[model samples]
Target: MSAPQHPAHAQVPHVLAAEPPRSRPSSIEHELPKVGKIVFRVQGIPLEVTLEGLEKSFKSHFKRSNSQENTIDTGLSSLVPCCYGSGHQTALIQFQPQTPKRLESLAPGRCYDFEDPDFQCRITIDQDFMGSTQLYPTISNLRIEADVVAIPGINGHAYGSWTGASKQNRKTMWLRDFMRKDFHTCRTMIFGYHSALLEHYAHTMSDYTEDLLQEVTRARGNAEEMGRPIIFMGHSFGGILITHSIVKAWISKQPGRLCGSILNNFKGAIFFGTPHQGLQHLDELLEAVKKNQGRKALLESIKFGNRDLEDTLSAFKRYCQETKLEVVSIKESRETRKATKGELGELARNGELVMFVAVAFSELKLPENLETTAMAEGDHSSLIYEQGGYV
Candidate 1:
């Protein structure tokens, strides 16, 4: 599929400073170790904290706590900022692979106190997804029958986007905890990309679409594996990316080619709160971008009556009709809280939020029986979490 051309003003520098390099192929193996190799979320961090400062404090704390044991390794592998809420900052902390028993000592739900000469803070820690682009093995005896890949929307975390606070106020990642139990024979995976709405040098939607295709191709490995049935689950803008990817694969289909193999095995897709037509609050979001000096290329492509989005959706529908691919559209029924920039550069709540995408805009007008539609109980951001019962 030919990528749509945007106005010159929508173009930005191609340099992707925020996006990390593609993860090592071996690091995303289907089977993962039970202990040392883990990614966890840290909450309650002050907005002013820097990655360097956070790392230094963690290293110091870990070293002090494990000083009695000379053999313990207290090295950190990576620390990247993640978005969980509006008021405070959150991050994903990953430890070095060599520390096989580290998690046993510092388990989830543990709180840590970090004291610095400049400031002091308390943070809560919890386990995150095993790794980006890795498959989640089934817990049942049922044999693996299909692959389910999930992609989060703009400003969404691969883990946090699918996770939500339950009625008991406990964080529940539905993909790992709930979907695995229900789809016993299906291997699930989550794809992460740099889609922050406010990023200054963010990649275009085409860039993300290509990255997703390449990662899935690498993850599937051999030809037989690539030919296995696959279902895609996308939320918000994620659904747009998925549509572009499928259309790309369909256009590039050829015998024995990777894209062809993927398109051949593509069986279905599920979209949660995806704006198939466009967002209802496009002007408001654009205004927010202007006020905050944010990137606009991606947002511009998804505005109401956007030629690119309409073309992509049309092509996606055509592909589904010819291939008989099943599709499920889950629309959000509530309003999502909007975050505004405060005087201190922190994101603050701006009164009551408005619905970003309307129900009509969220649903795809597919041919008669080609698509199934359902309404979810939460807002746009929470629609993915609502899939627990919908699935």
Candidate 2:
């Protein structure tokens, strides 16, 4: 598919100088670490503080020291914590070269009491462990460099969705193998989150967005191509998460210390089998849930034909216009147990450039205003595996 023409809409120009010079790549470049991760278990995690909230508090910890002229070296590439279980919190902090001393200060057998206007919380560090080094294979020999971050859909596996499923025992995972075998210079990372669609509890897309923002900030430290372009790839519901994350960052005024680099440097996005326009298949899903007396939250969440979708796409389009972002929308082909709404063309409706591709078995009718291409023999997931289909 050739690139879509830039839309003739009101312009939102980007200010090049507004971005920091340090955020750009330097002449002297260094390769990213082969493999690295560090984790700590802290008890007495405040119940009131969500992961995003906790991350904000942690950022404050660094800002305060920097203001005092006693800057703490906090070089975490990503700070992702396991689900709070029994009031105990476990976080995997990925970094490059070495772990941050500020994090190390949260050592085992240490206790800290934090006070605030809203609430006071106490933390007891129980254990700390150095993450293994051989989790991911090395790519230091690659010539080109790009940060490729993948986000899985609802109830999807972070590693499995891209690497291929475990039980099948496939010799090569799509993402890992593709990058390793095809494009040696690309560095890949999976953005994982809790996306169970039918949970008894309630969680909005905004919550998931915040979770992704936390991971993006944490991963920023270890990015091999920090100054280079970043590709935000999302599958199914993962697309929604990416959209919300950017909007959330914008809403927060692009706080200099929180995911500002990601927003500034993000150059492109690839959405797979995503329901950018409401999920037309949702009516049947809601019907089934209504018959079985499912949770109201789930019902309300998937209700189609809402203004939320339009509002989000509008914001995304505005950002793309400002940054000249490249967007690729891929729809599924072939029928499954249930159909998913896959009208994602609007993501590129107002963008300067876009590649709209459709996989075989997909019956989606592309908008007449946009040019689209079809894959001869591919399904929703298989399309991504195709060479040059995603890259």
* Cα RMSD for candidates in order: 14.5, 15.6
User: Could you give candidate 1's per-residue lDDT for residues 1-391 as a string of tens digits?
Assistant: 1211211111111111112232223322222223324456566667787666666665555553544422212232223322222345555555443332444466433444344544366665655332243333454465557777888877667766776555444445656544444454666778767655554656777787888887777667665567778878888888888999988777766555558657877877887778888765655446556744435656788888889888888998888888767677776777876655556744444535777678788777786476767766667665665321110
Worst 10 residues of 1 by lDDT: 4-13
User: Model 1: runs farther than 4 Å from truth?
Assistant: 1-63, 66-131, 139-142, 254-256, 291-294, 348-352, 386-391
Residue 251's lDDT within candidate 2 is: 65
- Using TM-score as the measure, the top candidate is 1
lDDT (tens digit, per residue) of candidate 2 on 131-217: 111113335464435556777765454544443222233223345433444334445566655443333435566667777777666
User: Model 2's lDDT to the true fold?
Assistant: 0.45
Best by lDDT: 1
